[model samples]
Target: MTRVISILFWLSLAAVLAFITLPLLVVVAASFSPTATVTFQPFEWTFRWYGDLLSNRWLDPFLTSLKIATVVAATSGVLGLLAAYCIVYERLPGSDVLMSYLLSPLSVPQIVKGVAIVLFLSMIGFQGFLGTPALIAAHVVLALPFVTRMVATSLANFDANLDRAAQILGAGKLQRIRHVLLPMIKPGVLSGVTFAFIISFNNIPLSVFLVRPGDSTLPITVINYLEYSLDPVMAAVNVASMAFILVVIFLFEKIGGFSAQIHGGSK
Candidate 1:
C-alpha cells in the first residue's frame, strides 16, 4: 500500500508539472512559427517575430516596465525589512494591530484596490500622476504585503540567542542588525524583492488603470496590442518575458547565496 501511494504521488507530481509546462511549451513553439497563426512546420519557422521586438513600439514599454519594476522591488524590500524588523524583532507596542494594518492590502482584491486608487487620484486632482508615478505607487502597494509577510516570517523564525550572543559580545543594535540579522534573512529579502519585480513587471489589472498613453508597461502594451490582432509576435513577447524573469531569479539567487544556504541547512 505504501508503494502504491508513492507511485500515485509521483504520477500526481508529473501530471501537475505537465499541466504547468505544456502551455509554456506551446507558447515557445508558437513564438518560433513563421506566420501569425502558429504552425508546427519546423522548416517554416522564423525569427522575424522576435526581431519586431527591437522596434520602439515594444522597446519603450519594455524599458518603462523594467524601470518601474526595479524601483518597486527596491522600495518594497527596504520598506518590508523595516516593517518586519519593527513588528517581529523590536516587537513594538500594538505590534499585532500594526501588522494587521500593514497586511490589510492582502485581504483586498487587486482590482478593487486599483479602482480605488484611480478614483482617489482623480478626486484629488493628481491626474498628472496617472502615468509612471501612479504605476510605481500602485505596484509598490500591491507588492508590499507579500514582501512584509515573507520578511516577518523570516524574522519570526530567527534564533534570538544569536542576537543575545551578539549583544553580549558588545555588538551595537545597528551592528547586529546590519551584520547578523540582514545576512540571516537575506534569502527571504531577495525572494521578496524578486517576487515584487516579477509582479510589477507583469501586472495588468492595476497597470491598466494607471498607465497613460505612451507611458504603458510591457504587459499593458502587449495586452493592448492583442486587441488589434492575434500574432506570433505576442507569443515571442511572452517567451522573452519568461526568459527575463528567469534571468532575474538567477541573479537574485546568486546575490542571496541560495545554493550555499541550502547546503548549510542540509548539514
Candidate 2:
C-alpha cells in the first residue's frame, strides 16, 4: 500500500508539472497558427512570425540582451566567486558583516533598487541607460546575490586540508588554485555562472527602469508589441523567447554538467 501510494504521488506530480508547462507548449503550438487568433488544434500553420522576428527592431534588442547578459554574468560570477572565497576561506576582518551587506540586496525589493539606481544616476547627470552598458549594470546587480549564495554554499563543505596540502607541496597561490582548489569547487563556480546568467536574463524590473529608447531588451520589445496590438504574433514571440532561454540552459548544462551544481551531488 505504501509503495502504491508513493507511485500515485509521483504520477500526480508528473501530471501537475505537465499542466504547468502547458502554456509554453501552447505558445509553441500557436506560433505557427495561420489566423490572428492562436489556438492549439488542427489549425492553419505558418512560420511568418519567425520571419518577422528577423527585423532589426527585434534583432537588435535580442543582440543587446545577449551581450549585456554575458557581460553581467561574467562580472557578477567573478565578483561573487571572489567574495565567497574571501568569506569562506579567508579570515578577513569584519568578513561576516561584509558578507551580510553584500547579500543584503537580495532582501530589498527590486523596485526599490531600480528607483534608487535611477535617482542616483539622474542626480549625477549620467544618462547612459537605454543601452547595453546600463543593462549590464542592472543584470550584475540582480545576479550578484544568487551567485554569492551559490558559491558560498559550495564553499561551506570545502576542506581546509586541500589548501594546506597544496602549500606543503610547494605550490604557489595561483598554482594551488589552478591545480588543486578550483577542481574541487568547480560545481560552485559553474552554479554561480548559471544562476547569475539566468536570473539576470529573466529579470524585468531593473531592465524596465534603466532601458532607454531604441535600446530595449527582449522583454521591453514584447511589451511594446503588446501595447500596439493583440495578435497571435505575441504567442510566437513568447515561444521564441522560451526557446532562447532553453537553449542557454541547455548549453550551460552541456558545458558544465548543470545537474551536479544544482542537485549538490557528485558528478
Candidate 3:
C-alpha cells in the first residue's frame, strides 16, 4: 500500500507540474518561433517580435506600468512598514481589529474590489482613475496587506531585548529604532519590498479597471494584443517579460538573500 501510494503521489506531482509549466513552455516556444503564427512541431527562432514590441505602441503602456508599479511599491512598502511596526511593537488597543481590517483585502475577491473602487470613485466626482495618481493609490492599498504581514511576522520573530537594551543605554525611541530595530528587521523589510514590487507589477484586475488608454500597463497591453491576434508575438512578449523578472530576481538575490528574507517572516 505504501509503495503504491508513493507512485501515485509522484504521478500526481508530475501532473501538477506539467499543468503549471505547459503554458509557460508554450509561451517560450512561441517567443522563439520564426513564423508569426503559433505551432507545435516546426521550430523557428526569431527576435522580430521583441523589435516589434519596441516599435509598437506597446512602449507607452510598458512605461506607464513601470511608473505605476514603481510608485505603488515604494508607497506601499513604506506604509506597510509603518503600520506593521506600530501593530507589532506597540501592540496597541484594537491592533488585532486594525490588522484584520487591513488584511481583509486579501480575503476579498480582487475583481470585486476593483469594481467597487471604480464605482465609488465614479460616484465621488471621479469618472476615471486610470493613468492618474489615484490609480497608483489603489494599487498601493492592495499591496499593503502583504507587505505589512511580512514585516509584522519579521518583527514578531525578532528579539525584543535589543530594543530594551538600547533603552537602557540611553537611546531614545528614534535612536533605538535607527540603530537597533531597523537593523534587526532588515530581512523583513527587504522581503516586503520585493513582494510589494512584484505584486504591484503583476496585478491585473486593479490595473485593468484603473488604467486608461493613455496609461495602459504591460499586462493590459498583452491582453489587447491577444484579443486581436492569436500569434507568436504574444508569446515573445511573455518570454521577454519572464526574462525581465528573472533578472530582477537575480539582482534581489545579490543585494540581499531572497530565501532568508522571505522565510524569515514565515515563522
Candidate 4:
C-alpha cells in the first residue's frame, strides 16, 4: 500500500508539472511559426517574428517598461531596507502597527489601489502626473510591501552580536551598518529588488489605467496589440520579454550570489 501511494504521488507531481509547462512550451513553439496562425509542425518554424520585435512599435514599450521597472526596483530596495531597519533593529514604538500599515497594500486588490491612486491624484489636481511619473509611484506602492517583508525577515534572523562586536572594535553606527548589517542582509535585499523589477515589468491591471497612449509598457502594449490581431508575432514578443527578464535575473545572481544567501537564510 505504501509503495502504491508513493507511485501515485510521483505520477501526480509529473502531471502537475506537465500542466503548468505545456502551455509555455506551446507559446514558445508558436513564436517561431512562420505563418500568422499558430502551427506546431517542426518544419514550419522561422525567426521572422523575432525580427519583427526590433520595430519601433514593440521596442518603444519594451524600453519604457525596462526604465520604469529599474527605477521601481532601486527606489523600493532602499526604502524597504530603511523601513525594515526601523521596525526590527530599532524596535520602534508601535512597530507592529507600522509594519502592518506598510504591508497594507498587499491586502488591497491591485485594481482598487490603481483606481484609488488615480482618483486621489486627480483630486489633488496632479492630472499631469498620469504617465511615467505616476506609473513609477504606483509600482513602488505595489512593490514596497514585498520588499519590506523580505528585508524584515532577514533582519529578524540577523545576528545582533556582529553589530555589537563592530561597536567594541571602534566601528561607528554608519560603519557597522555598512560593513556588518548590509553584508549580512544582502541576499534579502537583492531578492526584494528582483521581485520589484519582475512585479513592475509584468503588471497589467495597474498599468492599464496609468500608461499614456504613446508611452505604454510592454505588457500593456502586447494587450492592446492583441485586440486588433492574434498572430505569431505576439508569441515572439512574449518569448523575447521572458528571455530578457531571465537575463536580468542571471546578471543579478552573478553579482550578488543570492543563491548562497538564500541557502544561509534557510538554515
Candidate 5:
C-alpha cells in the first residue's frame, strides 16, 4: 500500500507539472513553426517568426515594458525595504494596522483601482500624464503590497539576537542594518523586486485603462495584434519575452542566493 501511494503521488505531481507547462511548451513550439498554425511535426520548424519580431511594432512596446518593469522593481524594492523596517524591526505604534493598510491594495480588485485612478487623475486635471507616468505609478501601487509582505516576512523570520550582538560590538544603527539586516533579508528583497518586474510587465487590465494612445505595453500590443490577426509571430514574441524574463530571474538568483534561502542556508 505504501508503494502504491508513492507511485500515485508521483503520477499526480507529474500531471500537475504537465498541466502547467503544456501551454508554455505549445507556445514555444508555435514560435518555431514554419506555418501559422502550431504543430508538433519536427519538419515544420523554422526561425522566421523570431526574425520578424525585429520590427518597430514589437520593439517599441518591448522597450517600454522593460523600462517600466525596471523602474517598478527598483522603486518597489526601496519602498518595501523601508516599510518592512518600520513595521517589523522597529515595531512602530499600530504597526499591524499600518501593515494591513499597506497591503490593502491586495484585497482591492486591480481593475477597480485602475478605473478609480483614471477618474481621480481626470478630476485633478492631470489627464496629460495618463500614459507612461500613470502606468508606472499604477503598477507601483499594484506591486507594493506583495513587496511589503515578502520583505516583512523575511524581517519577521530574522534573528534579532544577531542585531543585538552587532549593537554590543559597537555597531551603530546604520552600520548594523547595513552589515546585518540587509544582507540577511536580501533574498526576500530580490524576490519582491522580481515579482514587481513580472507584475508590471505582464499587467494588462490596469495597463489597458492607464496606457496612452501611442505608448501601450508589450502585452497590450500583443493583445491588440490578436484582434487583427493570429500568427506565429505572436508565439515568437511570447517565447522571446519569456526567455528574457527567465534571464532576469537567473541573474536575480545568482545575486540573491534565492535557492540558498530556500534551503535555509542563506547568509
Candidate 6:
C-alpha cells in the first residue's frame, strides 16, 4: 500500500507540473512563430514579433509596470519589516489584533478591494490619484500581508540566544537588530519583496480599475491589445516578461545569500 501511494504521489506531482508548464511552453513557442498561428516547426520560427516590443506602445506600459512594482517591493519590504518586528519581536499589547488587521486585506477579494478603493477615492475627491499613485498604494496593500507573514515567521523561528549573547556583549537593542536579527531574517524579507514585485507587475484585476488613459500597466496593455487582435507579439511580450521576472528573482537570491542559506540548512 505504501509503494502504491508513493507511485500515485509521483504521478500526481508530474501531472501538476505538466499542467503548469505546458501553457508556458506553448507561449514560448508562439513567441518565435513567424505568424499569428503558433507553429512547432523551428524552421518556421522567427524573431520578428520580438522586434515589435521595442516600440513605445509596449515600452511605456512596461516601464510603468516596472516603476510601480519596484516601488511596491521596496515600500512593502520596509513597512513589513517594521510591522513584523513590532508584532513578533516586541510582542506588544494587542499584537494579535494588530496582525489580524494587517492580514485582513488578504481575506478580501482583490476586485472588491479595487472597487472599494475607487469608491473611497471618489468620495474623498482624490480621483487624481487613480493612476500610478493608486496602483502603487493598492499593490502595497495587497503585498503587505504576505511580506508581514513571511517576516513574522522568520522572527518566530529566530534564535533568541543570539540576541541575548549580543546583549551580554554590550550591544544595544538597535545594534542587535541591525546585525543579528536583520541578517537572520534577510531571506524571508527578500522572498517577500520578490513576491511583491511579481504580483504587482502581473496584477490585472486591480490595475484594470486604477489605470488611466495614458498610464497603463503592461498586463493591462496586453489585455487591451488582445481585445483587438490575436497577435504573436503578445506571446513575445509574455516571454520577455517571464525572462525579466526570472532575472529579478536571480538577483534577489544572490543578494540574500539564498544558496548559502540552503546549503547551511542542509548541513
RMSD of 4: 1.9
lDDT of each: 0.90, 0.80, 0.79, 0.91, 0.90, 0.91
Scored by Cα lDDT, where does model 5 land?
0.90
State TM-scores per candidate: 0.91, 0.88, 0.90, 0.94, 0.92, 0.91
TM-score of 5: 0.92
Candidate 1 global TM-score: 0.91
TM-score, structure 3 vs. true: 0.90
| Clashing pairs in model 6, backbone N/Cα/C closer than 3 A | none
Model 5, poorest ten-residue lDDT window?
36-45
Q: Write the per-residue lDDT of candidate 2 for residues 1-267, one digit (tens) a residue.
A: 999999999999999999999877777777788666654457867999888888887789888777778888899989998999888777589988988988999998888888888888888888865467777877788889889888787777777688899899899999987887777777777868877877776678888788888888888778877888767777777777778888887887877645766575422
- Reference-based lDDT, residue 59, model 2: 83
What candidate 4 gets wrong by more than 4 Å, as runs, is: 1-9, 40-42, 265-267
Predicted structure 5: clash tally: 0
Q: Write the per-residue lDDT of candidate 5 for residues 1-267, one digit (tens) a residue.
A: 999999999999999999999998888878887766765556556889899899998999999999999999899889998998999999999998999999999998989998999999999999999889999999999999999999998898899999999999999999999999989998988889998999999999899888876788999999988898878899999999989989998999999647857988443
Off by over 4 Å in 1: 1-17, 40-43, 257-267
Q: Please tell me which model should have the higher lDDT, number 3 or number 5.
A: 5
Q: How far is candidate 3 from the true structure (C-alpha RMSD, Å)?
A: 2.4
lDDT of 1: 0.90
List ranges where model 6 is wrong by over 4 Å: 1-17, 39-43, 257-267
Angstrom error of the Cα, residue 254, model 2: value is 2.5
lDDT of 3 by residue, 143-201 (tens): 89999998898899878887788899899989988988887777778767777777777
Higher-lDDT candidate among 1 and 2?
1
Model 1, range 99-171, lDDT digits (tens) per residue? Answer: 9999999999889999999999999999999989999999999999999998898788788889899999999
Worst 10 residues of 2 by lDDT: 258-267
